[model samples]
Target: MADDRFSMGLFDARIKDQRHQVFKVLGMYFVLMTVAIWGLLSLFWGSTYQLESYFPSVKVYVYDFDSVATPNAVLGPAVVRYLQSTLSSPVHLGIIVRDPAGKTFDDVASEIVGEKAWGAVVINANATSNFEAAMAGTGGLLDGQWAPKGAISLVVAGARWYQVVLEYLLPYLGMYVETPVLEASHQASASFLSTATPATLGELTSAQQAALGTPFAYQEVDLRPILPGQWAGAAPLEAGLIYYIIFAFHIALFFFFSRLPLQGMTKKHGIKIRWIHVCLLRIVPVLFAYFILSLAYTLINKAFLLPTDGNGYASFGPQAGFMVLWMLDWIALASLGLAMEAMLTLLTLKFFPLFLITWILSNITSSFFPATLAPKIFRYGYMMPFWHCTTATKHIMWGTRNRLGLNFGVLLGWCGVSLVTICLFELMWRRIEERKERQESAKDVEGQGAHK
Candidate 1:
């Protein structure tokens, strides 16, 4: 009876001590969480506002082929002048003028493709002749021979946001180039018709000038359109929501498992199971929660459920292919969360700091802009799991036939690597526990020997 009372007293004391430790850790967790919330809000909002004051610099290579002959000067110089004038204030242009007399369109386009420049402008050789043809209303057929040709061709890197900015500015730039060309065309036509009737020429010239204010013609081709449709067509926020949703679920699951009680499987029931098995078992319940939440969210949104056309240009749909992709993505998320929780088990209190680091890094990821344009450190953010999830989700929803395979490869790779890491961590933890148990047994044996 006395031995039983002693063992009961010791068990009660141990339980009390454990309870105390749990309360202490919980208190610290609450305090840290409060601080983290405040700090995250301030940091995220502050950086966004600060980044607004600066404009990304774009480099444009301009090759002018317009002949500077008399009667009508080349419009190549006029195109450059207009580009320089309008593509400013919001976008800084680094215009590199190549001698049109020597360089061909292929050379400049190749250079832009090589990343030597963001975009290129090639003005054809017959700009002067074409302007004269327009003035004469000859439909580019002057003196019985068609004018050699005059057109501006733009070749730009399509994936970068800064390059897109330059492309958008082109139409506005037509305002500058078109006004001067029309004025010159009007003067030439009025002069040619003056001998017939001055009053009639004046009226015709005024009317024609007003109607043909914008006569310059240009064509643009993006080197990396990636899809059939314009990259600009995808809303940045809609695409970014993929990252946000996965991130929320990943972090939440990480915390859930970190604080979960393992007594039932570990000791109370005396079940014989490996830690890896426990980790794998978690997926069943997690998948249930994920499916329920995802279904509810999808229903509420309705936008995601709409069938996509999957047109040659832009893919649109919520079809079976998308469902399979989403399922794989969910599995990857589960593996990611489990791996993080398992790895951090030994350093439980550090989860908050690690979470903060991940949150900040993800916020700075190049979602709306070109990854190459971001800071050197932020360029590495592409490797973050959330970034891959965002890319895959966006491509599945709206992108053309590009990068879907790569995205799937990356996600599945992360899952395998993370699971392997967790197994290694489990082995290490088991070894540590075994050593401690052996030492405690030795201590107990020695104490009993002394008592005997």
Candidate 2:
């Protein structure tokens, strides 16, 4: 904390112990940046291009059967072609054959629902005019049985994709009857209104008549925006993948810089500086360098799947912000490594344990695979700096607000902890160097006294 030490410590050390091949370090960093950034971007870009071209999403299936209709007896294929032509080319429907002899109408209906087919049309043998009258009008009889005069029964499957398609296309795609669905009559104001009315036919214990009311309401749910654009697979994964690789390299650079110089490399002027300062001092340049590479790849390789509203500047800006925040994980990891290195440097015992922690943290947090692929409670590194940060990358790239707050908080916390750790380690490292000087000076004095 002395004024002279403040002004001269790192500066005097840099000038005195400067390497003849400091040129070599710059060269190594260039080779590293070029190879690491170029190779990853190339491989990822190609993979993304091929996958997008090969796969088309959203497949639809339809089944239409007519036993009673004298006209257009084979209606299934025509219906399939019509539906396919109505929707986009990628949205396709295949016909499923249903023989009147093989299964009953209801049995085939159940099969349509069970096979995960989107919907089925059934045209029974009794094509009576009273079918519509049976369906409406106080449950009137059509050939002595009940249903709308022209209504045909449709059994439809409801799943994520099926429902998403059905919500919009169902109204326009299905077979046309005057009534979209058959409505049953029920009594409104009476004792049966609460529960005494039949909830199901099998559960009915008493007979009851009820008035039926019908006012049609329809629904359609679509997740895409008004101006739909698609992004998927490797394109979306690129930002995080680069962040991981750069972060890993940064970690290795930190450790390598902190390593002791080759033996017998001491300077002539009695000035000694440990390797920790080399790593810490270069943080600014290293960050700027990594950011420049990231910006280059993002702008050049449009192949990376980014989910965006397509503001080029917004994508570039947020991506840069994400990279800076992502870098914090490794930077914090390096600081923790430096603190451990300071302890190991003083001990002069086994260094393997220190190296082990450094190596493991680098690999495990690198996002070659994400932390979430395992259970939430991973024992190996549940507490480390990058664990939560990689998770945040997924949320951020998803262009959702889902864990943005949590990810930012945890990463910022790691940075806070790492800063405190570096300050303490710097103080400890300086004391160790000063103590070594005192011991060497004492030995020299003793030698002089002996010679006298």
Candidate 3:
């Protein structure tokens, strides 16, 4: 007979049994993956759910320097009243009315630069007096005529949280505060103009007449601007973070594969290698590999012309910034990769994808959205690697805040924890493998005895 085992009929009983076993395994895997995917989806979606409800956490200071205006000026008080009324609404920001006493515009600007506040609204000093003087044509001339842009200033640090400032905070301020204040100021100016004498009106130049019609104009000042073409440099802090994690995982994987030949030499060729040496081999090479990979990664960014020098946006000089960024990438890779290496030893290739999904989702959620705009539970993001990395990267690229010490400390802490876990897990994995080999040896001895 031909090889019946290898050439079974379509309806053979053996074929039916094998097909059934394959289907059962596939069904189990499908169900497990479905549940795992649902859980990960919930985690990512929950981070951004009802995000607007947490808007109050993003604080903005509104200081009315024009509060003690001349008796006739209603612009400053009217704007303050309108902004205060918004505090009662369900969807309102943390609009704090700061005491202007002992505080100047420079002070408020400094506070924003220091990351003390997200943004600020300042009604300039002598705002009402200046408007009154301009309307009466009595103020000192500029460029041979008196003309002011506005009495109010909207100060922001756009590079702090670029998307949030542009999308939520700026729009909210425009809708609730700026629009009504401008309308009320225009109405008040028109009323004042309607009652003015011709002599007073004629004394006003064309510019002064126009200024009287809109006496409450406002100027927007972004302290730390995220200028055009700078988003390339910011990539590592955003979606590039996810890519970095993936690269780190692959680096661990590449090393894992590279070890197979050494294992083959030890097992098939009887080459002696100590277990402790093997463990060290796994970790020490990873550090060197990350150092080189990080240098390449930083160089790629530089090749793309991502600004590294102190271009008024960053404080570090050209070569110094590049060195700092390379060091950061090296630590980040080690922190992220070492943990995956530890987990891989325990979970093995079969189940590692489940852990990988959770790791990516958790880090991305924390880094992509500002904790201030998310639920209180997300405050833990402060401890996550991605959040610190993003914060530090922004500071390096855009000079947002100087927290390098804290950032480096946290990243190094992660590396230490991962290093410990890797060693312990590697030892455990070797113990399990040795136990399996001993069991197989015992079985072989019994079979040989039975054969005799």
* 1-452 per-residue lDDT for model 2 (tens digits): 55765575544556654653666767876786577557545532433243222222222333343333334332233333444454454433333444455556556545543434445555443322222222233333434433332334444433212223344335533533222232211111221245433543235222112112221111222221112233342332334444444454554355445544522255445565554664355344444544555455444333454433222212335656456434544444343343344444433333334444343444343333322222333334445444454444333333322344565566556546544554565567668878988999999999999999
- Per-prediction TM-score: 0.62, 0.37, 0.91
lDDT (C-alpha, whole model) for all candidates: 0.53, 0.40, 0.80
**Pairs of residues at least 3 apart in sequence or in different chains that clash in candidate 1:** 308-316, 308-317
| Candidate 1 residue-wise lDDT at 224 | 43
Highest lDDT scorer: 3
Q: Report the C-alpha lDDT of model 1 over 316-377, residue by residue, as the tens digit.
A: 44565446445645654554454454545434445634553544445445454445444444
Off by over 4 Å in 1: 1-73, 81-91, 94-130, 140-200, 203-207, 211-262, 269-272, 283-311, 314-346, 349-357, 392-401
The root-mean-square deviation over C-alpha atoms between each candidate and the true structure, in angstroms, is: 8.5, 18.5, 2.9
Segments in model 2 whose C-alpha atoms lie over 4 Å from true places = 1-266, 272-282, 297-305, 309-376, 379-387
Better of 1 and 3 by lDDT: 3
